[model samples]
Target: MWATGLGSGVRALTTTRFGGHSRPPFDSLNLGIHVGDDPAAVQSNRLSLAGVLPANPVWLNQVHGVDVLQADRVQSDQEPVTADAAVTTRTRQVLAILTADCMPVVLADTRNRILGVAHAGWRGLARGVLAHTVQEMAMRTDGQSRIHAWIGPGIGPDAFQIGPEVRETFLEIDGRLEKFFRRDSSQQGKWLADLPGIARWQLLQLGACDVQWCGLCTMGDPDNRFFSYRRDGQTGRIATLAWIET
Candidate 1:
């Protein structure tokens, strides 16, 4: 459990690939059920994770899109809600987003009564997932003075290479986005994109100036402790979750 010390009343964590019943490839602590990992292993891992939390995590059937939902609106835990993000002002509602190489962004107002978590893949980011999540949080937080965001691990800029179309998507959002992508000299027609840099730029535009990053890269480490879909084609996912304390 990697904690994000956002402040007094909020708790956030990004799980590691170690500590569960899964086998190689999806080896131990694999929390994603949609991936090829065994359902039993995934459930067992979730159950183990539950023992440490105030309540069961409100998981989403993330579609790599920008849809954001309120945790209180989730009708059933058994139903997989097809949204990429979840936010709540209610305490103890463990809002979670699963990620392997994609970024897991967690947000909380300075008051710590409202919290949000988002799964931001390149598609989601290009489509404004972070911006949408920040808007929802600000709506709930109305007059709050600050919105703090913690950006969890993902494939770093040095490891993420993309084609022209991907760069165009971001440029469509903002022409200045070109600064976040650098030409990969070795790979023609490819550029190394900065997922975290793009996220920080979006958050800052939305007035979330206190953005914090857990500098560890999922694909950079050779230990395989942090799950990386780009590194291992068929791999497990780590959950980066946030909940307000009662």
Candidate 2:
């Protein structure tokens, strides 16, 4: 577990690919039920995770889109919501985002007791998922909250290779994003994109006063500490969770 340094009133952390019941490719701690892991094993893993959380996390059916859900409105019996991000001001209402190479971002406004988490793949980032999440949190706080953000593990720059079209897509969003990509010498016409850096830039642009990153890379994990879809075609998902503590 990697905890965020977001001060008091909030609890946030990203889990590693350890400490659970799944086997082989999904490994011992696979948290995703939709990833072809055994349902019983996934349930056991979730129960284990829930032991440490304030409440059972509200999972999202992340589609790499920009939709954000209000986790406070979610009920325990409700099915998983179909959104990439979730926000809440309610204490102990856990918000979770699962990832395998894609970034998981947690945001907090400790003063106003707002919390948010987003599943940000390149597609979601290009589509403004972080922007939408920040906007939602701000809206709930009447646009006066001083938000802080913590970006969890994902593929790092040196390990994330992208094509010209992918680079063009980011450039189309913001010409300044060009700095986040550089030519991949080993792979002709391919670029090494800085996934976390782009997310940091986006958060700063949204007026987040403080931004931090776990600085771990799933794709570069030789120790198998994290799950990486780009590193392994079929793999388990690690989770990033956040909640306001009572």
Winning model by TM-score: 2
TM-score of every model? 0.95, 0.97
How high is the CA lDDT of each candidate model? 0.86, 0.89
Q: What is the Å distance of residue 140 in model 1 from its true position?
A: 1.9
**Residue-level lDDT tens digits of model 1 in 158-220:** 999899999999898899988999999998889999999999888888888588778878998
lDDT tens digits by residue: candidate 2, 1-246: 656667688888888889889998999789998999999999999999867887888988989999999888888457998999999988888889999999999998876778889999899999999999988898877657788899999999989999999999999899999999999999788999999999999999999989998888998977879999998888899999888886
> Which parts of model 2 have CA positions greater than 4 angstroms off?
none
- Candidate 1's C-alpha lDDT? 0.86
**Candidate 1's error at 5, in angstroms?**
4.5
The positional error of residue 139 in candidate 2, measured at the CA in angstroms, is: 1.4
Best by lDDT: 2
**Candidate 2 all-Cα RMSD:** 1.0
